[model samples]
Target: MSLSRNILLWMSENRWMKERIPKFGFVKKAVKKFMPGETEAAALDAAYQFSLAGIPSVFTKLGENITQISEAYAVRDHYLRLIDKVANRKLDIEISLKLTQLGFDLSEEETFKNFTAIVSKAKEKLGNTVFIDMESSAYTQRTIDFYKRVKKEHDNAGICLQAYLLRTDQDILDLVEFNPAIRIVKGAYKEPGDIVFKRKILVDDNFFLCARDLMKNRSNKNVRAVFATHDEKLIKRIREETERNGIQKSKYEFQMLYGIKTSLQKQIAKEGYRFRVLIAYGESWYPWYMRRLAERPANIWFVLKNLF
Candidate 1:
């Protein structure tokens, strides 16, 4: 890792700093990098801006790890409301959700019910797509199983996979059989080296390999893939693979977070490829916001610049 990235990782993982910084104005400023503002209006404003730029979006509310069924259902309700609002505006946007935020820890059945409600809402409101984000290894199997079942009930729902994990190759194979949309990401959570490949180069290599496999083997034409990264070389590799496999440009899209690498995103769009930006909203963003900074250390420079 670069020295800057190492510092970011340290800031993100340091429990002491996490507890202290949010008390200061750091949380507010850090949030502006990832979130437009803390309301649905702020999120919708972002969606409008991206749409106006000819880019599309997938909105997510950034909070997870729910222990209560009621809290999960509340999250479900918020997403359901988001569906209605986005659809009413006829915006070119979709949504992603974390399963744990939907009460996965409470019970499998309850989590499914929450998911069902959210998916149903998405279907009802202008048929926007929904993606369920994959979490840590402890919940990986359950998340995959839930995606399978949810896809059976809803046509527009999907899931995310982390390229860092060892079992992801097989996971992709199994999931493609369901023909659900997928977003492949280099995972953000810190994990033990055993279950996950610890080296950045290996993780990135795995991501490229998976992107190729998806482009080559996905059965449904509309079963799309989102290559979510800021790495230019990785993007180039996927671009080559997509062309080599003769996958139509519209069959897949490039994805990046909202505030990182705006120029790169625009350039990719200008080059005639579809780009979708992930816009995160909500007040519970300390963990998620920190991870975003860790992914690219330049974000820390931005933070520091504003501090003075």
Candidate 2:
């Protein structure tokens, strides 16, 4: 990563920075360029608009590492109502969330219960899919374990995997038995060199390798894959590999963050490939926005231009 990106990512996890940064008007203005708004209503409206444009959306209300059971239940309830909202509006949308946000930090059992409640409700009430977003490397094993246990009961659920992690290759192979639905991402966390690829090229290479594995395994019919990236070269490689393998475009999708690459998203959707945008909204957006900047350091220029 570039020096500026490294700084921004470090700041992203700084407790003091995260608590104080979003209080500035300039910061909030920059955030609006990424998220529609910090309310469920705004997020739902954005998804509706995307549906009209022939693109599906995935919504995640941002906040994580809850310390209280009540707080975790509140998060679950919010998603439960979100599922109902999607069902009532008949919107083509899925939901994504962090396990920690559901109470993993407080109690693994409580987190599992909360996660099951939300996903079960989504599956039973609306036939909607739920994606478990991967966090930092510390929680990787536990997250996968929880996902495996959950997958045994609900086939509609999926988990996100970070390509930047050194263990992701083995992780994918291990998950082959489940024929998992995975969203592959070039991880954004500021991780140690020991456990993650420190160079962008290595990360890109691993991403393509993982993509190839997923595409080649599509014959299983249960390996639903989503490539969550904005890198054109990597996207092209995955597209070519999928075509070379004769994998149907319907079996996997390309996902982009909302507002980051509107034109590219439209182009992908226009080509008849499955395309979805992750639309994140909520008051707890500072860390997420900083991570977005770390994902593409050049975007800081865009924010600066808009701000000044």
Candidate 3:
């Protein structure tokens, strides 16, 4: 990675930086450019707007790594209420979550129990789905294991895979047997060279490889692939590959973050492809915001423009 990108990612994990950065008006304003606001109501309002635009959404509250079971339960309960709201309003949206936020740090069993509760509630009440967002490499295996256990009972549950990781191709192969639903991302966390691809080209190549495999497996009714990226070139490439391979547009969807690439998202949706926006909200957004900047350093110019 570039030096500036490394600095932004390092800052993303710095407790001191996270604690203080949001205090600045400029920083908070820049964050708003990415997220609608820091509340469940705001998130739903954003989702409502997306629905109006004929776009679906995925909601994820901004926080992770809870040290207490009560905290984890609180997170689960919050999502439960969100699910209720989605069902009550008949909204076209889904929920995504981090295992750590559900007490993975406390105990894997406890996390699974908490995760299962939310997924079960979503399935029963909303007839909707929930996705487990993959975190740093440290939790990759554990997250997949948790997904496998819950997915055996609830097919509405899905998990994310990081294309930047060296093990992802094999992971995709292993997961195909279950005919799982997966969201493929280019990964955000700064990982060691041995376990992750250091160059963007390598990461992009792996992303397409994994995506191609997922497309080939689309004949399995249970297989769903979500390409969660903002790279138009990669999206075009995937589109061409899928078209050439006789894959239907409905077989997989393209996902992008809310407030980023709205035009491209609209274009994709207009072209009759499945498109979903990830709308994140909550007070704990500093780290998430920083990672977003790291993902595209050119966004720093956006932040500067917001500041000025």
Candidate 4:
């Protein structure tokens, strides 16, 4: 990662900044560029608007790693209601969430219960897959295992995998039998060079390679591979490869964040590729917001502009 990105990722993990940064007025203003609002209603409304533009969306409320089991339960209930709202609104939206947000640290059993319940609800109501949002390196193994367990019971279960991890290629191979809906993203965390690619070009190369690997399994009707990034070069490479190999668009999709590269998102959709926007909202926006800037430090300009 670049020095600016590394610093932003470190800031994302700092407890003092996590507590205080979102309290800044300009920071809050800047975050609006990425998130619709901190409310479920705002998320639903944003999804509705995106749907009109021929772009579907994945919805996630942004808090994670909760301390209390009750807090986890409340989150579960919130998602259940959000599912109901999505159904009522008649929108083309799916859900993504972190396992830690559902009490994974406190109790795996409760986490399993809450997650599977939400999955079952989505299966029934939306007929859609619920995604497991991947976190930092520490949770990687447990998350893969979690996805395996969820996949065994639910066909509508999906997962996010990080391309920057050196082991992701292996993880992708291990998951082939499950025929997973894998959303591959260029990782944003501050992991060690021993475990992850320290250079951006290597990560980009690995992302395209892994995406090509996923696309090769395109004939599998159940496989739903989502390449999640805004890297134009990687996107071009994937597009060329897809066309060269005659891969159908349904075999995979492109995903980007809500505010970044809106024009590219529309152009991709117009080109008849499957595309989805990740729409994140919630009160716990500090760490997530920091990572957004880390992903592309240029976004710091937006925050700086807000300051004036």
Candidate 2: where are CA atoms >4 Å away?
none
lDDT per residue, candidate 3, 70-139, as tens digits?
9998998999888888988999888999999999988888888888889898889877779999999999
Clashing pairs in 3: none
Ranking by lDDT: 4, 3, 2, 1
- lDDT, residue 99, candidate 4: 95
Error of 1 at 215 (Å): 1.3
In candidate 1, position 246 carries an lDDT of 77
**TM-score: model 2 vs. ground truth:** 0.97
- Model 2, span 1-308: residue lDDT tens: 68888999999989999889888787788888889999999998999899998998999999977778899899999998888888889988899999989989889998888888888988887786899999999899999999999999988889999999999988988887886889999997888889988888999999999888777766765788899999999999988888887777887899999998799999999999999999999999988899988877887887777668
Q: Which scores greater on TM-score, model 1 or model 4?
A: 4
Worst 10 residues of 4 by lDDT: 214-223
Q: Which regions in candidate 4 have their CA more than 4 angstroms from the true location?
A: 218-221
Model 1: per-residue lDDT, tens digit, 120-194?
887787676789988878889988888888888788888899999988888888888777788899887666669
Ranking by TM-score: 4, 3, 2, 1
Range of the 10 consecutive residues with the lowest summed lDDT in candidate 2: 213-222
Clashing pairs in 1: none
The Cα error of candidate 1 at residue 226, in Å, is 1.5
Clashing pairs in 2: none
- lDDT for each candidate structure: 0.83, 0.89, 0.90, 0.91
Worst 10 residues of 1 by lDDT: 1-10
